[model samples]
Target: MMRAFFNRIFGAKEPEPLPIAFGSIPGMLDEREAAARAMLKEQTRDPEQNIRNGIAQLQLIVNAIAGSEHDPEIHPKLKSIAKNTLPQYIRAMNTAMAKELPNDSEEFYPAAVECVKNCLNSIRGPGRYLQIVFPDEMKASRKGIDTIGREINAITVALGAYRKEMAALSDARSRYAAIISCSEDLAKAAEKNQRSRLRIDEMTGRLKEIGQEMAAMPSDPGMAQFTEMKSSLHQLTVQLEEKTRTYAALSMTASHVLRKAEKIATKQKHNDEIAFLKHAMALLSDHELPSCTELNTALAAACPVVERMIGADEIVLKNKEERAVFAETGRFCIDMVQICSDLHAQEDTCRIAHEALDAHPIHQKTGSLEREKVQLEAMLKKERQSQTELTEWQQKTQERIPVLRDELKNKMEGIIGRTVQYSDVFPESA
Candidate 1:
């Protein structure tokens, strides 16, 4: 009776538990396995597409975190998470994708599955606070969250201001560095100009000396040699004069450029240093507490000092230019003396050559015909020797000219390059 009652209560259709023989349902497990295999095959075949979809989703999360407004209904709870927490979620997602996507086996599948699970969990769990904080339900309590958000916004605004102040300070420092470089370059150029001027003066002095010696040569036995010496001296004097003029022009140009650079440096040192200090003060005030009036006073004080430095630099530049001019004048005089000396030496050589020719027996012969033949032979020999000497001198001069010119050109180019590199004459605005 109890068994019948139990059967009736439970439903006598306690159908004999379906026969549980493995072979009886032959294809059941196999179908399940096949279905799973087919699903896996589909996923494997389009891995690139899956990865692209994942990356797109990641970008969406990143964009939302970066401050994109989202529909509260669509993202529900994500909106309530702290602004900093979104970055953490992104990092976790990236880690999971990296671990999961490369392997075909189940090992990585769990990581991918976990990534999705955790993301959903995060939105439903602690991230629910985000929904409460930023809810679509107008009736939800949001006063506290709004107040905190406002405070954070104010802090961010302050930080932005501080960054601007710091940037100004950096700019000021760069200006100062440029100014200092220009000043140093100007000083060096001034020195070089002075040296060049001095050299020109020395050359001029030597030329004058040569001119005096040439004028003193008399028509004596050695007079022919003196004449040749005079001619050579004249040529050297002309060359020295030309070089002196060129160096003088170069000195002027250098002096001008140097002065300009010095002026620019002075201006920069005066203005930029103060600007840097002001910027630093601004940064300090932003980070700490400082009065605006104090910054204004500091800037005012800096301006006059900068102007004074600029004036001083201008004075220095002027002095340097004058000194260079004076030195070059002196060099011109020295070159004149050198020209005289060179002429004297050339004259002496000519005299020796003439004397040797005169000492030959050809010139002393008494018989007209015999003398003529001897004179002719002597003259021919002298001509041949002269031609050889001239050819040697010409070759040596040609080789020397090109080498010297190239050296001069290279030196000039180096100077120009350095000047451009170190000078702040160019405007920074461009």
Candidate 2:
């Protein structure tokens, strides 16, 4: 008695579940599903057939209710109510029975349940009113609905475990497929990471070699001349900068006075004077040094405008620099002309020196190696970035594989009714 009471309390102690492997899950799941389907068909066959026969009995009862005549002695009110409600109950029952139940277990289960519920509702809802008038028909209809309900209940009880097993089997299939796909992706990512590492090493080593070669490059025959030209270019650049600065200061001051002359000329409608003043100011304000001849010509025309403005008191020189520059406009023009000429000559010399240096093997080789070094550094950075992303993916994938394996193991244990030991090797975690 105690043993039976304990057994009733806990049901039966389940046996240990069977073991499976990560790789064999698909084939095993397929075999289990096929067996379950065959079992479902066998178990559901009699119940489904009974449900159909019960439905036929229910439909016949519904038709009998439709065609049966009411008693002439019955109360007028009850007869009128039955006349109205009888057709409604018949249509409801017929509509419920109209559904053609499918043969598949998955589809047949719900469809059978729906028919049972609908038939029961029709009997409970409208048949209650007609019970007195059509007593035999209503009683038969209720019995038919009960018969169908019982068969549907039997199907439900029989498939409860099958549904749970199918669900577990389906879950195992998904987990196993995901594990396989994850393994493939992890492998491809690892291969790409390896290639990236190799390429990065190659570029890194090449960069080192380039650095060594640049440092140990032998002296060339024209190196002496190249050094001399480089020094000459630097000196010319310095001299030209000084000359340009001096010329800018003087020209800006003179330009201020010239602008006043231009405004006055505009008011007086002296187009020629305005043009001369604007042309000279443009040359001084230009980013590049104007030709010496261009400066001489522009100043020759424009200086007279500033001098005339000073003579006519149309402009006032505020600063000492302005006064000095405008006070001796002829000397200023001469100095500007010499400065621009020297700048042009120096720039030409610098240009020729730059060309010679660029054409030399040492400079050309050095520039090429430096450019190559920069390119290799960029490629190495990109490779490192790719490697980092791949490493992160591999880590996440490696972590996920074990989790999926554990879940699949649990699901397989549930489905197969045993403690499932996965017999497959897994990739190591990062």
How badly does each model clash, as a count of residue pairs? 40, 5
lDDT of 1 by residue, 315-357 (tens): 3434654445333433532443343344445445556655654
Best by TM-score: 2
lDDT of 2 by residue, 1-430 (tens): 9988998998977766465555677788889988988888888899999988988888887887788789899999999999889889989889999989998877999998888888888888987899999888888888877887788888897799688778888788888888878988877887788788889889989999998988776566666776777787788788878877887887788777888888999999999999999999999888888988899999999998889888888888898998888888899999999988887887787788778878978788889999999999988998898888889888888888878888878888777767868665765332
lDDT of 1: 0.44
State which candidate has the highest lDDT. Answer: 2
lDDT of 1 at 399: 46
- What shift in Å separates residue 210 of candidate 1 from its native position after superposition? 2.3
> What would the TM-scores of all predictions be?
0.23, 0.85
